[model samples]
Target: MPHLHGRVAAQESVFARMSRLAAQRGAVNLGQGFPGTAPPAFLLDAARGALGRFDQYAPPAGLPALRDALGADLGVDGADVTVTCGATEALHLLALALLGPGDEALMLEPVFDVYLPQVALAGATGVTVPLTLDAARGWQFNLGALAGAVTPRTRALLLNSPFNPTGTVFTEEELAGIVALARQHDLWIISDEVYDELYFGPRPTPLRILAPERTFTVGSAGKRLEATGWRVGWIAAPPGVTPGVLGLRQITSFSAPAPLQAAVAAALPVARDAGFYDGLRAGYAARMTRLASGLRDLGATVFEPRGTYFLTALHPHWTADSLLDAGVAVIPGEAFYARHAAPAGLTRWAFCKSDAEIELALTRLAARPELTDV
Candidate 1:
């Protein structure tokens, strides 16, 4: 019998496990980051129209028009963009292209769950630098820790802005510090900006804009369009890096679905003109506010998010399992950390859910006030 890959067989993803538990318990699931809403009508219409015209494999790099649209959105040349199955695949391809045995990648903690695994799969080590969580300031980047983590063997810095689980959008100062380190160390920068358009405050500056020579920007049309099922994503690399990404992509998923790529291409311009992004930001802001307020009312300390649809909260007495038992599901903050335990009692909740769903989870939580006393 053949042995399975060790990491692949070790454990199911916490997100998948929690979502499954939520289903089994018939609870309002706030564990995963997927949006509860559908993509806007115009985007759906474009997908339908595209499906009628494009049914074959797209060019491994992407449909030319989609690449062009992505380039326009990211302020990069079209030839530098390579479409991928999702930002997940883009990250994996990057690991394969830029890292190997004896190399290290700097990962900011709470890291996205995929970063460490992908680095391991590429035979590279992930060096994690934990961010500080201030009650008033939210998550703060530790420039000193990042600098200390860099080694001669370090190959890349993997970054996520409008960061997941914590929803901390990296500030320009932090980004600049990171860029400076990348420059000083001669390391590659893989910027995961899938949630770029979902910011609540000022938009985050792309790292590529600060250090184009060594940065690769990864984006997700699915996240921006509120259609995670589409799985349309791309990497906007510097000209020299694009070809390697495209080559790895050819053997990975080959290309994202042609119609989906076409649909995203068609929708990007219309979404921009119709203020779809503004509406998305406004809607998610309301949801986050509602959830945060409810958690506060229940004696939980909520970290107000500046962007993204998730927030981390501290309820010393409540665990994620306890929340699930109370009819709502969430992810434990520890799931995001690679090297350190999450601050005691922190858990991540997703407000990407519909208003009613958010309210129901809050109501369920309110009914179990004793859970917080335990």
Candidate 2:
């Protein structure tokens, strides 16, 4: 038997904790970030058909059709694609393949919870730079602070734009600043872009598009297609990362489900088009307005989002324990940060659910003021 490193040792994840409490209270859950509704009709229908076809193990990389469709969408080739169970698995494989004991990966504060754990479990230190939100810059952070955080040990930069919890879209200037640093230090970048198509304004640009030579972009069928349970995702990397990512993927996942891959292949082109993505943004925008306005009316601080399906609220007296007791389940802002303390007290609520679900949750929330109780 071997002893696990302290970084790799963990308790229950934030998702499990909030989900379990939500179940127990029968509360209207805005904690879990997945959609409460079914995927689009075409994707679901494709999934059903996929069940009847290739029931065996999928190809190690992915179904050729799915890879080809993704390549066409991303402007990459099939050979550079490495499909995995989900974006989560893809990140894990990349971490294992790239990081060593002394390596460091820099991720933003108020960051995604999934990144730190994966980086830590891979025997690498996960460093943090903070992104703060206020009335002025919205969710933007100081580029100087980020630049100062890097060191010689920093081997990579982990990015999740259209960021979760904050919903801040990294502007072209911000990306350029980060790219300059990476180019200076010769750092690899692994981006979490699962919400790439869920923008509320102008289309978001990907890091790979800017610096394909040193970038690996990971995305999934879950967010845009509303198929979280399907767990089909792909990593499109530059040729430099081709060998390690492809080989390590086989060891971790072996193969993602053939049927889900087929279904995602059918769904990719639909999700790739501008009209479909715009419709998605429209739907989420309506819900965002509904929830963010309600929170503001309730006298809670709300940072409205530019992209992604999350709504973040800040209040002094919020906590996971208190929110669960108040019958509206949400994840605390503290859950998202690993190194730096959250700039203020906050909570994140998922607005990806049905309209009725979002309404019901907000209504229940309005009846209770315990969320702001100090």
Candidate 3:
């Protein structure tokens, strides 16, 4: 066999590995962040309607209708949007387009697992800035540490909010500090806002809104619509950067699935008019409360998430392996961090599951005397 690229050979997604283990062990699989429910009927209907007509390859940039719809929803110009296969691909495209050898990208610690590897793929150094967990404020990054990480080689800053693992939605003050740093350093901002609509509090302010000239914002139709397999996402960049990202898109996936793009276009207006986002927040808030309470009952310290359907808990007696054996699957907190050691006993649980699945996971944990025994 031909020798594989080092990056490809070295990469093993912990999510895929754990999901497989959970299946083999018959564990209630909270290890992956995918929703267990079907997408809404309106979205399915739109997909069906488009399947016959929009099946051909879309323009490399994307279907104009979908781009317009996304623009309207995101408050950006249609020309600024380039739809991609998913947010993962969008991030990869941005990294490749904006970074190169000897360049550096700053990433906050416990990043979405893809950020560091994508930076590496671009032949860029990824510098980690640790985010400390604050009991009252949730996860916070120090401006001083972030400033120290920037140098002449720094080209970009990658951020995820309603952040994965911790689920900390960046507040206005935090975002302002980050935006200030980006301006001072003349760095591009790649903000992953896949969970933008899934927030529980006042809607998150997109970084593009704060610093449009310097930010490339990533969003996911699949995440918002609960259709992860659809693989529909977009990058809303400033006009200056749009052409470069679209050029990269032509070489990458070329274009996202045309029918899926049309379906998302058709569904976006309906979702907005029907108050779907409000219901989504309410449902996830209830689920977060249920799961957080359940974990607390099991003697774990649950950090309540303000946005995103994930919760992190600290428990001296439980680890990912132990929980998997107890028939409840989770990802160890350490899997999310690139350089810093995660707090001892911290584990991330996906609450994207249904109430029934969450209860079953709780029951499985409660039944294991070894997990609760201090």
The clash numbers for all candidates, in the given order, read: 0, 0, 0
What C-alpha lDDT values do all the predictions have? Answer: 0.89, 0.84, 0.90
- Flag regions of model 1 displaced more than 4 Å: 372-374
- What is the Cα-based lDDT of residue 61 in candidate 3? 85
Show the lowest summed lDDT stretch of 10 residues, model 2: 365-374
List the candidates' TM-scores in order.
Answer: 0.98, 0.95, 0.98
Candidates sorted by lDDT, descending order? 3, 1, 2
The runs of at least 3 residues in candidate 3 whose Cα sits more than 4 Å from the true structure, single-residue gaps closed, are 134-137
| CA error at residue 85 for candidate 1, angstroms | 0.4
Best lDDT goes to which candidate? Answer: 3
**Candidate 1: TM-score?**
0.98
The residue-by-residue lDDT of candidate 1 on 316-348, one tens digit each, is 788898898999999998899879888998999
Residue 358 in model 1: lDDT? 94
lDDT of 1: 0.89
Write candidate 3's Cα lDDT for 188-214 as tens digits.
999999999988878888999999999
